[model samples]
Target: MSTAVKNQLRVCLLSVQYNIMREMVNKVTFLTSVGFMVLNNAAILAQWFILLRLREDVGGYTMREIMLLWGLTAASFGLAHILFARAFSLPELIIGGKLDAYLVQPKNVLVSVITSSTSVSAIGDFLYGILLMGLCGLGLREWLLALLFTVTGTVIFTAFALLLGSVSFWFLRMDMLEGQVVMGMVSFATYPDGIFEGVSRYLLYFVVPVGMAVYDPVHVLVSFDAAMLLRVLGYAVLLTAVSAAAFYRGLRRYASGSLMGARV
Candidate 1:
């Protein structure tokens, strides 16, 4: 790589390190928030145990498979929040004119904004993901597959958030729209892919792609389909391109809020 590119990466990494250190300043509060989130997630997973007891499976997913799905869901979301938490609040940043600080920076605006802060609670969710994977009795290969899926899924989740939040550049009141899109993606991501059919299924793979982030990953881990994994990775790349294009295009329409503030 060129020296300039290497320098840019070094700056980004340092920025991320600073953000993490900031988050760690209040170690007690950070640890408590992370621990509570993990417990809350576990409570939600417990409902699946009750449901599975009443039937062989729900949405063609066995109990074990469902566990994997939850694991992937939490892990992907955890990574997104940990690294790209600002993407989730892109609408607010734009609408509130908070992008001005990032705009003045020499680095990539989106990356700088997203990596400006780290979500401490997400660390717990990531640990829970590993614990759940162990519960699945995954072999070394499956564990590695899960890690790959988590990485791609994290990128996809962040891109999707950016795509949805970019609407604020055109319509300033996109908070509701962002919530709907994100919540819909999360709702579908934790379920079996077989449950949805027809257009809904198509939308899952295309519009939102929660299936690719969660279901397809789990499926690939279980069966190891080269084509399917490639499709997931390919879709992530395409989504990322689309998201970046959309953000920059909308930036042309961005009216500065003129308020100087950093993302908290």
Candidate 2:
């Protein structure tokens, strides 16, 4: 692509970013956010109620314990999006044909893409995540460990999401693939990682990357173990570096799906 063409695309994406930020202040965004918060956190609550009724039947967890876990996990769920929804939207940018515009932009495409979009719903998740973090039950040192792990978890989640999203450049159905993967991650996220073990635990922990978001961090926090903290922190940094490298490598292959470069 030519220089003038590239600059024009960056300018256009910047404009879109500004418009999105402006729209964030409106009533419509507020109401939609309220509705989704109700929906997203509903399952944990409903389960909490059901568990309370069946407390005698289920041997392991009490009503209060389940509720506490739900609240804790829910908060982490919120935190993940709050910190990295822009990166999470990488798949959408690819599928929505927005990437076609981004490719010609003079700025780094990843940076431009992030600036151009915001997941407004992330704010709701952020509020709840903070609540969970407080109650995860830790001494000052353990709390510090949890905070560190939470930050580490964010890095892992963002990197995992981006790696998955970047695959869309090669696959046509970016949204479908992204939705499936994200849904899988969400399904495992709030639930206690203790239920799965051996091979099952192995899958989530090392293979799929979902365990990074909740299980590993929660464990490290509860135990205040130095080794576990280092392990998770290492995964966070290493995975993030690997994922970013993968993204830029894929960016080089992005076709832009245009033969003539028509847009101004």
Candidate 3:
């Protein structure tokens, strides 16, 4: 290849790296907010309840590693707001028929709505993530890779939210059911992926991907297994594609009445 071509590829990779760094900073901010909002005010032993007990029960884990893991857990939830902060409004828009206005707008409705609101709740997650990164014995390169895992995991989880929210167009009347299911998925992904057994584990990791969002990616972060990390990338790609396809399919079925469907 030409020297110019090599330099161009190098610059492109650097740009991508820069963007990832900026996003990690954003994730850090989101987790930080969550700490101030919820975790910080709670008793320190809440850490014991939410974090320490798991290490004791699981064995072969240290308090420091547990703290990093706990921070990851917090950051995971914080990053979820990246999708859910907007997902929360979809049912209301559908119910009120204001969704029609969005349909007529000159921009992508999802883009507009998602951009219009953000989950500040994610700030807590970001706070915890930075702390977790600081606890590492790993090099900065390793730390950056972990951030990539967390961010990719965050995107996959948002895809989960998008999948759930898109269901509104189908049942219209079933938004509550949709919301409950998404929230339930939230419960599933909040903890480490290792804790579950058998079919439930299969469901979260491959079938639905909630556990992959935190568990597999975090596992790769903790262990530095290239093969396992590659598997996560594959899962992320497949899940994102499936969710996007599902959302567009649901979009075709959307029926905005004269706000009449909701009144009945």
Candidate 4:
């Protein structure tokens, strides 16, 4: 790779390391927070277990598949928050004109903004996902697919959040709407694809991307179709491209808050 590219990667890594170290300073609080998050995520599985007992399957998903769904969703959610926590706060950053600091930085502004913070609890979510895969007794191929799906899902989640948060630059009072969209994606991701039909399915697959992020991954775990996997990957790439384009486009219109003047 070029020296410039390598330097960029190095800088990003340093930022992540520094953020993690900062979070680790409060050792007890960090550990408790992470542990509690894991327990809380695990507790959600109980409801699924109970629901599975009531019927042979929900939306054609067996208990095993449901476990994989939860694993993929939790892992992706964890990875997004842990790494791209600042992306979710884009509406706030944009509205408050906090992008000025990042604009003055040598690094990419979007990257700098998104990686500015780390969610310690998300580490627990990632670990739980790995544990869930083990519980699924997946073979090597299946395990690899799960990992690929998790990564793809993470990218989709982050890109979608960027897309939603970018809307703040164009319109007022979109903060609550942005939160609702993220929450909606998260809620739908945990459910079965069979539950949705017609336009809703298309929306999930293309518009909101919960399908590519979670539903499609579940399909891969069950069937292992190469074409379907490629489709999901293609969607992730397209979404990332679109989100990046939209964010930069909106950045041009961002108004500098008075806080920027106070920074000096």
Candidate 5:
């Protein structure tokens, strides 16, 4: 690898470690938050279990496939928040002039800003996803595929959020709209892909890109198609490039908040 690439990776790893340590300072509180989050996800998953009992499948997704869907979604969401929690806060940072703190750092501004925070509760989600995968009886090969899917899914989720949040650079007070769009993507991702048809299916595949993030992964897990896996990887690369470009392009229009603050 190139020196610059290695350096950037090192910075990212250090930022993640620091944020995790900061969150863990209050160990009891962190544990409680994680526990509650896992329970909450379990409660939501219970509804699916109940629904599946009444019917054989929903939209051609058997209970096993649905389990994979939820597993991937939770794992991806968890990974995104754990690593790039601040991506979701980009709009507020831009509007409130919080970017000044990150911009002053020697590291990549977007990377520094996003990695500055971690969601402790997301630990539960990550754990819960693994539990669900086990419950669904994923073998070693399936587990490896799921892991790859989770990473790609994380990339898609973080990139989409950053892309939406970047709108704050051009418009005023767009945080709510961006937030809703992201929530919509997350909400839609947990359901069976077969449920949506025609225009809605297209929107899932392209507009929100949940198909690439979650559905396609689920399909690959079920059938193991190389072409589909390549498409998923391709979309992740494309979205990452687009979001990073948008962030840097918007940086030119960024007006520093000049707010005094210490990161450490």
Candidate 6:
């Protein structure tokens, strides 16, 4: 790899490590946050279990397949938050002039900003996801595919958040719209793809891209498909590029809040 790429990666890793350490300083709070998140996710999964018991399947998904769907979704969501938690707060930062802290740093502004924080509860979601995937009885190949899907899914999710949050540049107070768009994507991703049809299905694949993030991954896990895997990776790359371009384009319009504060 190039020296610049290596340096950027190193900076991101250090930022993530520092954020995690900072969150862990309050051990009790850290544990409680993580535990509560695990319980919250489990409660949601339990609803599916109760519903599945009554019916053979929902949208062509049985108990095991549903597990895979939830597993992928939770794992990807957790990983995204763990690595790029600040992406979700991009709108607030833009409006509040928090980007000023990142812009002055000797690192990629977007990377520095996004990696500057960590979500303690996300560790719980990641663990719970692994537990669910284990219960699904995946083979070695399936396990590898699941891991790859998790990474791609994380990229898609974080990129989507950045894309939505970038709107705060041209428009003022876009936090609500950004939250709704993200929530809508997550809400649709937990269910089976077979349920949506026509326009909704198209929107899932193109507009929100949940189909690329979750549905296609679950389908591939059920039955391996090289072509589908390639498409998922392609979508991830495309979305990342678009989001990065949008962020830089918007950066030119950014006005400093002129508030002075130290990151440390």
The candidate scoring highest on TM-score is 6
Span of 10 residues, lowest total lDDT, candidate 3: 57-66
lDDT of each: 0.86, 0.64, 0.61, 0.88, 0.91, 0.93
Candidate 1 local lDDT, 12-96, one digit each (tens): 7787778778878998997898899889888888788888899888888887898899899899889888888888888988888
Runs in model 3 with CA error above 4 Å?
Answer: 1-35, 38-61, 82-84, 136-138, 257-264
Ranking by TM-score: 6, 5, 4, 1, 2, 3
How many clashes does each candidate structure show, in the order listed?
0, 2, 19, 0, 0, 0
What is the C-alpha RMSD, rounded to one decimal, of candidate 5? 1.2
User: In candidate 6, what are the lDDT values of residues 1-264, reduced to their tens digit?
Assistant: 599999999889988888889999999999999899888898987788788889899999999999999999999999999999999889999999888878887878989888878899999988888888999999999999999999999999999999999999999989999989898999999989888999999999999999999999999999888999999999999999999999999999999998888778
Instruction: Compare candidates 1 and 4 on TM-score and give the better one.
Output: 4
Location of the lowest summed lDDT over 10 successive residues in candidate 2: 57-66
Q: Judged by TM-score relative to the true structure, which candidate is superior, 1 or 3? A: 1
TM-score of each: 0.94, 0.75, 0.71, 0.95, 0.96, 0.97
How do these models rank on lDDT, best leading?
A: 6, 5, 4, 1, 2, 3
Which residue pairs come into collision in candidate 1?
A: none
TM-score of 6: 0.97
lDDT of 4 by residue, 1-264 (tens): 598788878887888788889999999999998888889989998888888899999899988898899889999999888888888878998888778888999878888889888889989998888788779989999988999988998899999899989999999778888889998999998899998999999998888899889897788888888899999999999999999999999999998888735432
Error of 2 at 128 (Å): 1.1
**For model 2, which pairs clash?**
75-129, 78-125
RMSD of each: 1.7, 6.0, 7.9, 1.7, 1.2, 1.1
lDDT of 2 by residue, 110-175 (tens): 655544544556556655555545554547876666556556766676778788888877786776
